[model samples]
Structure formats: C-alpha cells, structure tokens
Target: TPTQAGHATIFPTGTSPGTSSVVNFAPGQTVANSAILRPGAGGQVTVHLETPMAAGTAHFLIDVSGWISTSGYEPRGARVETIEPVRIYDSDLSGGNLTGARKVSLQIRGAVSTDGGAAVVPPLDDVVGVIVNLTGVNAYGGSRPTHISLVPDDFDPNVPAQQPTTSNLNLVPGQTRANLAIVPVGDDGRIHLFTLQGETRAVVDVTGYLVRREDDTRGGRVIPLITPFRAFDTRLSDFHAQPLGPARAEPWSFEAFVNDVKVDGEPVGKQAGLLGNFTAVDLERPITWYSPVRTHMTIYPHPGGGGEDENCGAPPNISNVNLGEAEAVPNMALLRYGSSGMGPNRLCVFNLAGYVDYLLDVYAVVLTD
Candidate 1:
C-alpha cells in the first residue's frame, strides 16, 4: 500500500459489449493496481492511473464487448464480474460503504475492437419503448424499481444537459418473477425486441434454472419441428456438365433410411438427387443401358457445402446408367427432392443398437448433370 493508499470499489456488474466508459480514482495518484478476473466477466481489465494523486477523484474506462455473458456476478478475469447496465443499482457494489466510490456511465461512440472491423453504433433516438421483469423471488427483498432511463451515448457535462426522455415501457413485478421489454429501433427504421431476465444474472442460478425448466423430462417422448426445406441444390442444371456420347443413358435411383425415431415419425420424401439435364418427368421414358464405369463421386459433408472427408466412403462408380429427355426445369428453391416412399423420403426404425447413437449429418447422391 502507498502512503495514500485507500479503499477501492469493484463493480460487480461489468459493462456491456460494443461500448466503452471510464472509471476514475484520485485525479493525480499513481496507484499500483491489480484487478482480479472471473471467467465470463469482463476478463481482468484495469486502468493504471499515471498522474499525481488527487485527494478523492479517480476513474477508469470500460468497454462492453458484446460477447460478454449477461449474467449477474459474471466473474471477469479471476474474481471480477460485470453488472448489467440497467441493473447496476441492484448490484452489491451499489450498496457498499466505500468513502469515495462513484461511477459515471456513458454510451460508446464508434466503439471498435482490435481484431474486429469497424464498429456499428445503435440508433439511440429511435428507441421508442422498453419493458422489464424479474423472477425466482425466493427469499430476497421485495422488488423495487418502478421506472428506468437510457442516457444519450454522446452526452457532455461541459454543455447544459437536457431532460432524458422516457418511453412508455412496462415494468411487470411479480412475487416470484420480473420482466422487461424494449422496442429498440434498427437502422432500417424498424422496432426490434429486447428483453432481460434476472434469473440469468449469475452462473449457478442460470444453470439451475435452465435444468429445472428446459431439461424437465416428464413425458414419454418429444420431437422438435423440422423445417420443410432442402439443405442443398441437387437438381439437374446444378450438376450439368460437358456433353457425353448419346448411347441412350439410363436413369439413376436413390434410397434413404432413418433409425431410432419416436414421436413425429421419420421424414418422408422422394428427393430428386443428382441428374444431368433430365427432370423427374423424363423418367417416364427409358433407352438402351450402357456399360457402367467407375467415376469420382464427391459427397459433401453438409447440404450446402463442406471440406473433403477421406474417411467417409470409397468413390464408387455407378454403371448401366441411363439418360432420358429433358422434362420440367428444376426449381432453385426445391434443390433436393423428398417424398413418402421410393424417393428422397423419410423412414422410421423403432429399435436402435444399445449404447450406440448415430446422427445423419449429410447424405448426397452425386450425378453428372
């Protein structure tokens, strides 16, 4: 401790991401400082004052990195944690008895990251509304906040300050819960949704809350909804290449399967895999079959794209292939096809291998379109 070393207050509520604000101490004191870090909190950030010690004025700047966790008491570097911008008053530091502890909040302007590109500032004037709530009252004191305000990011003390406007925001206070809602304006002049919950303030509470609510297992089985869309463009024109000898090519066929299905039955569909320039209608007519030859068939790891995987399967050449006349054009939207049966369809398998689980990541039928 220096000759004039005094007590310092630590903000349990760290700043938000994409913004920067400063914290100051005795104006001219060269205080030797070390900040404790708590993971997920603003990671061990401290500003060393360089000037001579001022009797009772000192401050430091804080930057809100958007990726920071919005939890209560989120340990920053070692033992540090950040407070929510709106919940700072409820923070433990807010009630501490430090003699000269005071912080000034400010909105960041063009706040840029070292590695990230140029920063994009949110529209402050376009903020039209806000609402908030809290839950899990437990044994804590009764909730108290009735209203809230958001100061301008460019507010200056040197100039006369204007009244900070308030929006028609709702503050629902419940015996066991609290809630907030804000209609933040976007660059496109549209209102976006913003909400905050008190349960997500700290790590332990959040883990317990999520496990009790989302991970509850009481029913026999549950299945999430699947989007009715194709993952990749497996149409003819998409795979069409240079012309081949006219030997009356044969049509290609594909089969798909699903296992360990419980509730929503497996996916069903007649998906048109890979085809040269021929459409589904062309399969109506057939011609002489030519001798099958081995060719390179690259199966992408993902529907849209992916890197090559050597362990997937050996490139197998499909023979006795057939070609038909061009029918209907392929739809860019329905790049791949799926149907009830005998197609890009869904299949179900009730019993699965014990202690074994398999997830179908990607399955492609490559053809020379």
Candidate 2:
C-alpha cells in the first residue's frame, strides 16, 4: 500500500543497532516497537522504505514467543501488579469482528478471578512476561491495518512488520492508539493478540507481571544492546543547555530523571534490561519537517518525586524513535528491571511536545541476570 504516502523504517541490516528502530510505516499508517530482540543470527530483520513503494509489494511476518540465554540468563523475581487500566478484551463487548487473521486469548493466569477481582497475573506457575498497555481503539478500515502483533500464541503466525507489539502509528478512520508490549505468556497462561487487517477495538492493560523462580535454573536472556553509549548530553551540560524552551508558565513539556549517573567514582547500577536512545530537540521551532508529531520521549521509573502518576510503572518505555526537525532524533528506549523491592531502578523522561533537550545513550546493559 505504498504508491503514494510514504514512510517505513525497520532495522538491523548490519551493524546499526544503536538501539534498533524496529518498525515504522505510514501511508496506511502503522508502526511499532516494544524493544525486544535477541538476534545473534536467525532472527534477522531489515526494512527501510521511506518513499519507494512505487510498485509496492511488501508483506513480511515473523513471530516467536520465547528465547533467552545470557549464559542462561536467570532473572527470577519481579512481581508487580499495579492495575488501573484493566479491560482484557472487548471485540465489541464479545460479539467478534477482527477481520482477516485474528487470535485473542489474554487470560494471564486467574487474573484475580478472571479480570473482575483484578491483579494477580502470571502467578500460576511463576510466569515470565507481561507489561502491557496495548490499546487500539477506533480502528475500522478501508484497507487500514498498520500493525499489531503481541506474541505468544505458542508459536507460528508473525507479522511483526519487523518486530512490533503495538503500532497504529498513522492510524486513521477513527483513530485510537496505544503501544507498549513485552508479551510472552503462553504456557497456557495466555497472551496472543494478532491483527492482519483492521477491525480494531482492542485494549488490554495489565501493567506488570514477570516472575520465574521455582529454583530458576537460570534460563532467560536476550542481551542485544548492540553499540550505543552516550548517557546524557544537554548540549554537554553546564546547567541545562539552550534548547528546550516554551513553557513560559510551565506547560511546554519537561521532566528529567537521570539521577546519580557516574562511572569511575561510584554509582551506576540497575541492570536486567535496557537498550537506550532518547534524543529530542526543538532548538528552534522544528516539529514537522519530514513529518513527526507527538514530539516523543517518555521513559519511566523515577516516580521518586511524584506529584502523582504513580511513577507510571506499567505502560512505560515509549519512544519508537522519531523527532527530526532541528535534528537529533533518536528514540529507541526499552525497560525491564523492577524486582528487588520494586522501587528505584532509576530513569524518568517525559518531553511530550514542542521544545526538547535530552540525549540519553546506553546501548546495552544486562550485566548478568
């Protein structure tokens, strides 16, 4: 569907994983990136079509439910159940109308007496995967089916566009978008939302769950931080550079949470998962050049200074990567490390709109576990 409107950017062609982009396609609009890739070989992905769909014939799909081996990457213990946005499934309140290819089964182990009591996920047998906020509201169609592929149907059936979990990026025809997925549930625990066409009306907001330890023989690992290490560059810091502006009375968008952050002296802890890249810069009224709305940037877990947002532990970890008007557009952020007591793992970034300045960079860090 690319004879006119253009846009597409999937990654991993070869040595270009500064925190992979993973998915993007707008013409019919649909883009996704929940940041999960373990590719050392077989899972190879690469797509890049910003404009050429002239004759257009691109239909690729790849779905897998499990894989990890950081020397058997054993990280068993992360029990968070912060609810609030709960609605397991509602294909029009259970009538059924998904269109082309469809599959839905978000049970998540006795979810508190089946989503009525609420909260109690993946605890059936020490589960291992869940952190969602996947929403795709008004998405009827006219040939619209940008993206949607939450994994774990046991295996088989993949249209990740490249590696998506939530993408309605350019969604039209009603429009309602939400993206944030870390799917991996089927051992009968359930979680497999698919979509090849467009019928839309999907909303599953669980918010947290990832536990695996019945004597975990150390077996989960996907360390793919593939080269990218900058960490912070407010134009090289002196006292917040000269970029981010607009909040004359405070509203333009701003919130930073870099915390301690040190190296040869002390401080620098919090590992289990993280593949970073969050670059935003308004600098001089540059919002739409090549096209990019929603400015971008919202990396959570620094609710320490809360006014209230509950630290946003669930649908957190956004930045499918976009924002290039003034230049410095790099978004690929991801997370997975809330287990010791479930508090300070450090990281909170929210820019949201016009006016920006942030250059975080941490290409990889799964240090063990």
Candidate 1 segments exceeding 4 Å error: 1-104, 111-142, 151-165, 172-369
How does candidate 1 score on lDDT?
0.22
Model 1: per-residue lDDT, tens digit, 141-246?
3333222223223233224243223321112232112212222222333321111222111000000000011222221111211211122222335334212222
lDDT of 1 at 157: 26
lDDT of 2 by residue, 146-218 (tens): 4556775644444434343543233445555556566667778887777666566665655455666545332
TM-score of 1: 0.17
Where's the lowest-lDDT run of ten residues in candidate 2?
248-257
Which parts of model 2 have CA positions greater than 4 angstroms off?
1-127, 131-178, 182-189, 194-211, 215-270, 275-319, 322-332, 335-369
Best by lDDT: 2
State which candidate has the highest TM-score.
2
lDDT of each: 0.22, 0.48
